[model samples]
Target: MFHIVFVEPRIPPNTGNAIRLSAATGADLHLVEPLGFSMTDAQLRRAGLDYHDLASVTVHPGLDALWQALLPARVFAFTASATTSYADIAYRRGDVLVFGPEPTGLDARVLEHPDVTDRLRIPMLPGRRSLNLANSAAIAAYEAWRQLDFAAP
Candidate 1:
């Protein structure tokens, strides 16, 4: 399975959608705080994610803790500034796909993190900023899953 990590997420519905994506793809979800909303917030529930859909999620206090837990795996930072396409890489099982918050994408410090294996971006129209958080994760996760031939555990 792949690992989807959201750093300092600032939206509830996006994360709720990610939870559903995680459930559907069997890819684990990891969130780094401080989140914009509580896990129990009504907005999250309103997105239609339920307890079972959240089973694959794991919340981390910070990036440091996340590195410790997910070491020995390739962590790709998704950023608009990246020169490499997300599809260029040969994804393997247990790879980690990391995304930044909504309003602003990943900061320079995060892109420079030692644990981050490389940077990637999804192609978009010229002058367009970026895709929705949940949508980006879904795109990358589906690509990786497809590369693995949609294997099941």
Candidate 2:
């Protein structure tokens, strides 16, 4: 399974949907704080429904901690400004798909991190802003999974 890293996410419903995504895809979710809402947030739980316990979700205090834990993995930071398309990559089992906060997206510093193998983007029609956080994650996750033929028994 792939690793989904959400850095400084501010929206509860988005994170909740991501939790569901993790459970459905067998991907682990890593959240870098400081988060805008509590893990026990009702809205989040409601959005995730009964899948929270089924997903492997971990929260890290900061980016350093996240980097330390996910070292040696191919980390692909997703951003709308990137030149590379998300579908162009040959994703592996342990690859890390890193996303930024919903409001601001990934900072320039985070995007330039030495650990990031590349910055990727999902193509959209002309003049569009961006897709929702969870939607973007689902798109990337399913694309990677599809590349591997779904890898289900």
Candidate 3:
């Protein structure tokens, strides 16, 4: 399983859907907060996530805290400006797949962060800005899982 990190997510259902994704895929979901909605543990569970799904999500106070927990792992920051397509990478288990907020993608600082092994992007048509937050994550997650033969214990 991989780790899906969402930075400063603004939407509620996007994160809720991600919880379900994590539960199904066995990928742990990490949220860097100052979140757009009130996201208490009970609130998350009430959002239709069972205890198992909620257990797959971890909310960090900030990027620094996220780094503390996920470092020494290959971090791939997804951004539209990235030259590398998401499919080009040979993703592996434990690799951290990072995404930004809904409106704007990853900030320059994050893309340039030393810990980021590289920056990646999901291909799109000529004029598209980006895909939905949860959608992009699912695409990448499925691809990575596919490469890993979709292993499950």
Candidate 4:
């Protein structure tokens, strides 16, 4: 029941890959406004995400729309500057795992929003750049699912 949210994602392939991850994990996928490409974009649909994977995808005009639709679920912002590692958080069902854009990352305003429960980071090599957005989201989602004992029927 976890929700994977991407804020103003800039790359189509990354988002497409995320959609596949969502479908595989049974997580709802939310995409915020100002996307770099359309859902019908050829590249996007061809990036290993099939139409079935898009079944659970939801497009929000803005963060406010997402807020309204996903209320009561705590949002955990994933940022490179965070002090707490993502694994340290006791993730729960229905929590929203929020990620940022490819190059610029999350907006400070969004990261600091009152609704965001906490900021989390993945430990990386010292002085290294951030991991690819899709990879980071997969790692976070898998860890959260792991903590849930790989929930399944």
TM-score of each: 0.95, 0.97, 0.91, 0.95
Which consecutive 10 residues in model 2 have the weakest lDDT in total?
144-153
Largest lDDT belongs to which candidate? 2
Per residue, candidate 3 scores C-alpha lDDT tens digits across 7-117 of 999887788778878888889999998888867545544543674433477889999999999988999999989999999999888999999998997898788899999
Say which prediction, candidate 1 or candidate 2, comes out ahead on lDDT. 2
- Local error of candidate 4 at residue 14 (angstroms): 0.4
Q: lDDT, candidate 1, residue 116?
A: 86
How does each model score on lDDT? 0.90, 0.94, 0.87, 0.87
The 10-residue segment of model 3 with minimum total lDDT is 46-55
Across 88-128, the per-residue lDDT of candidate 4 in tens digits comes to 99988999999999887899878988899999999999998
Q: How accurate is candidate 4 locally (lDDT)?
A: 0.87
Top candidate, metric TM-score: 2
Question: Model 1 Cα displacement at 27 (Å)?
Answer: 0.4
Off by over 4 Å in 4: 51-55
Instruction: Report the lDDT of model 3 for residue 69.
Output: 98
**CA-RMSD of model 4:** 1.4
lDDT of model 1, residue 54: 45
Task: Write out the backbone clash pairs for model 3.
Answer: none
> Model 1, clash count?
0
Q: List the candidates ranked by TM-score, beginning with the highest.
A: 2, 1, 4, 3
Off by over 4 Å in 2: none
How close is each model in CA RMSD to the real structure? 1.2, 1.1, 2.1, 1.4
